[model samples]
Target: MSTPLTVVCWNFENNGKGRPDLRAAGADLLRRLAPDIALRQELWDADAHGHKIFNEQTRALGLQGVLGAESCTAVFYNPAKFSVVRGWAQGRGPHFVLPPTALTLRYEDAGPDSLPFNAVSYHLNYASAEQRLLEAEWLTTWADKGWTTPGRSHHTLPAILAGDNNSYPTSSPGDLPLPDLNTVKNEPHRLHRSYAGPSGARLPDTRPDTAFRTAGLKDAALYWATAPHGDPSALSRTVNASHTHGPDSRVDRAYLTPELLAALTGFEVIEVDEALSDHHILRLTLNGDLLSDVLAPSMSA
Candidate 1:
C-alpha cells in the first residue's frame, strides 16, 4: 500500500503591483496547507526575481520547485515523498496561451520498476470562453494520447491535469447562468461568441464542462459531491462556493483520468485572503496505492 498524496492547484495571479505581499501571503497559505505537490499558474515573470521568489517559497515549505518557461506555470513537490523522474513543458500551440508543465514522479522508496504517474499544471485562456474551450480540447486530447502512449521503461500510470481551468464542470442548475448577449447590449468585449449555440442562439451556460467530460477526464470536486464525507452539508457548500475571481464564479479546477478518479479521496476549494490572489486554492487528495497499479502486460511490456 502507498501513502496518501495531497495536491494543491492554484492560480497565484500575475506577479505585479502588490506582488510582494501577495506572494508572501500565498507562501504562508502553502505552509498552512502543506500539500505533497503544488501545481501553480500565473507566476508571471520568468526573470531572476520570479525564479528567486519561487525558489524561496518552495525552500520555505521544504519542497522541490520546478518553474516553466516564462514563469507561466510551476510544480512544487515534497522531495521526501516523491522523486521527479521526468519533467517537460507541453508543446506550444495556437490555442494555448501558456504551455502546461508536465512531470512524472515515482514514490521515493518505490522499487525502480514501480509505476510512476504524471501531473500536468496548466492555465487556459481566461479572456475568451471560445479560446478556453479550444484549449481544453487540446489539453484533454494531449492527456489521452500521453496516457495511452506505448512502450515505456516503467509501467503506465494515471494522469492528473490540474490548474486554473477557468470553467465549470457542467451546465448544472446550480451553476451561474451565462448572461444573454443582447441583455448585455451586444457588448463586443463582454459577449463570448463561443458560447453561442446553433444559429448564434445564446447558450444557457458558457462553461467548457462538456468538452472535458467527453475527453475522459472527471472533475474532482464533482466526484466528491455525490460521495460525501465528513460534513455532508459542507460538501455542497464547498463545491458551489463562488468567486475565485472577483465575486462571481469558481474557475479553478483539477481533472483526473479514470484510473486516478477511482483513487480520489478528498477535494476542497479553499478560500483565502483576496489580497493573496483573486483565485481560491483547490486541494485534492488521492490514494497512492491505486496509482501504483501497473498497466496490463501488453502495455507494460
Candidate 2:
C-alpha cells in the first residue's frame, strides 16, 4: 500500500516587508498543498515583524506546531493524521548551548520502515560564502551523526535533511563534476547535492532524477525564473538581465534516504513566474505508512 505524504520547503521572510499580504499567501499555499510536513526557514519570533501574520495564517490552516528552535527553524504537521512524539532545536552559538538544530518525531502510520526521521529547517548564512560552507559542513556533520555504526543508539534517529542551504552545490559558481549516482541512489540518507556544475550557475541537468530506484523513492532539482518588478509595457524590462540564459536557478532542496524515498508518492515544485519572496516553495508527495517506532505501544483500534 502507498501513503501520500506532502513536504514543503520554503524560506518565508522573517521581516514582512516584501509582501503586504504575506500571511494570506502562506495560508493559501498551505491550503492548496495541504502537506503532511512543512520545513520552514527565516521565521521570526513573536516580537519579529511577520510572526503574528504567519501564526494567524497557520492557525487558520489547522496545523499544529510539532517542533522548532527558539523561534527559527520549525516543523508543523496535520495533527489529526500524525502526532509529534518529541522534538528539539539546534544551532546556538558556541558560547551557549545550541538549540535543537533539527525537529525529531514519529507518526502513527508513518510506515513499515519506522525509524525516527528528522525534519530540519534552516537559514544558512546569506552574506558570507565562508558561512555558507560552514553551514554545509554543519549539515554534513548533522547527517553523519548516527550513521557511524548501525546498532548504536543515536540522539536523533535516521533523519531526512530538508531546507534552504544557501550554499551552492558546487562550492564555487562555474565548474561541473560527475557525481556518484550510487551515492545518491538506493541508500538510506545518502548525501546528495542538487547543483553539480558550478556554485553560481543555474542548476545542472546532471542532478538526480526525481524518480530513482523504487516507485516510491525519488529526488530532483526543481527550478524557475523570477525577476524584480519592472516596466509596465516592456516585457524585456521584466526579465532578469544577468544569468538570463542559464539553467533553472536551484536555491531550495530536499534529501530523503532510500527508506524515506521509497515512501515518496509524488512530487512537484510550485512554479511561479514571480515569487512573493526571493525563493519558491519546493513541494513533493510521499506515499506509504507513516513512520512509527518499535519502542512505542501500538495504538488501540
Candidate 3:
C-alpha cells in the first residue's frame, strides 16, 4: 500500500495593478497547503517580478519549481518526494500565449527502477471561447497521439492535467450560473469572456469537459461520485461552489487518466481566508502505491 499524495492547482491572478503583497501572501497560502505537487497558472513571466515570486513561493513551500518559460504556467514538486525526469511545453505557436507545461516525474525513493508519469500544467486562452476550445481540442489530440511518450506508443504512461482551464465542463449539473453583471463587469476580461457575449448573441458552448471526456481523460472531481466516502451534496458544493478565477465562477480544474483515477483517494476545493488571489485552490489526493504499480515491471526485470 502507498501513502496518499496531495496535489494542488491554483491561478494566482499574478497580473494587474494595485494587487498588493500578492507574492508573499500567495507563497504563504501555498506553504500552508503543503501540497506534494502544485500546478500554477496566470503567472506574469514577462519580467523578473514573476520569476522572483515563483522562486520565493517555492522557497517558502520548500518545493522545487519549474517554469517551461518565463511566466505562462508552472509546476512545482517536493524534492523530498519526487524529481522531474523531463520537462517541456506545448502551445498554439512559436510564441504561444500561456502555453501548457508538462513534467515527467519519478518518486525519489523508488530507486533507479522507478517509472515516471506525466503531469501537465495548462492555462487555456482566455480572450475568446473559440480559442480556448481550439486549445482544448489540441491538448486532447496531443494526448491521443501519446505526446507524453514522444515516439514510443507502448511506453505511454498515465497522466494528470491540471490548471486554470478557463471553461466549465459540459456535463456539469447546470450551466455555471453567472454572477451579477455588476460583479462580473469589474472582474478581469478573461473571467467572463467565455460565458458572456453580445446582448443578443447566444452563449457559446464552453465545454472543455466534453473534450476531455472524449479524450478518455476523467475528471478528478467526478471520482467522488463512485467512492464509498463520496457525498453527492459535498461534491455538488465543491463543483458549484469551487470558482478559481472569480469568487462566483469555476474555471480551474484537474483531469486524470483512468489509471490515475483508480488511485484517487480524496479531492476538494480549498477556500482561502485572505485575498491571496482571485481564484481558489483545488486539492487532490492519491494512493502512492500507484507509483509502485507503474514501476513494478521494470523492478522485476
Worst 10 residues of 3 by lDDT: 233-242
Write model 1 residue lDDT over 1-301, tens digit each, in one string: 5678899988878853346766776777888888999998887653475477777777767899788777888888988888887776545355577777778876654455555677788887756777888777777754543333334443335678887765544645443444333444434434433356778865533456677788777777766655646222212321233322222454676777776666677787787666556677788876766545432324333
TM-score of each: 0.81, 0.62, 0.78
- In the predicted model 3, the residue pairs found to clash are 244-279
> In model 3, how large is the Cα lDDT of residue 159?
79
In candidate 2, what are the lDDT values of residues 124-177, reduced to their tens digit? 644444445445445543443342123443333445656665433432223223
Best-matching candidate per TM-score:
1
Encode model 3's per-residue lDDT on 1-301: one tens digit a residue.
Answer: 4677889988777632224366667777778887899988776842375566557667878999787575778888998888887776543244346687778788765565555677888888766666776677666643542322332324446678887776665545532454433443434553445554568453534567778888898877766655688644223322233343333555677888776666687888787553456567888887777656654434322
Candidate 3 lDDT at 173 equals 53
lDDT of 3: 0.66
lDDT of 3 at 49: 58
For each candidate in the order shown, give its overall lDDT on alpha carbons.
0.66, 0.47, 0.66
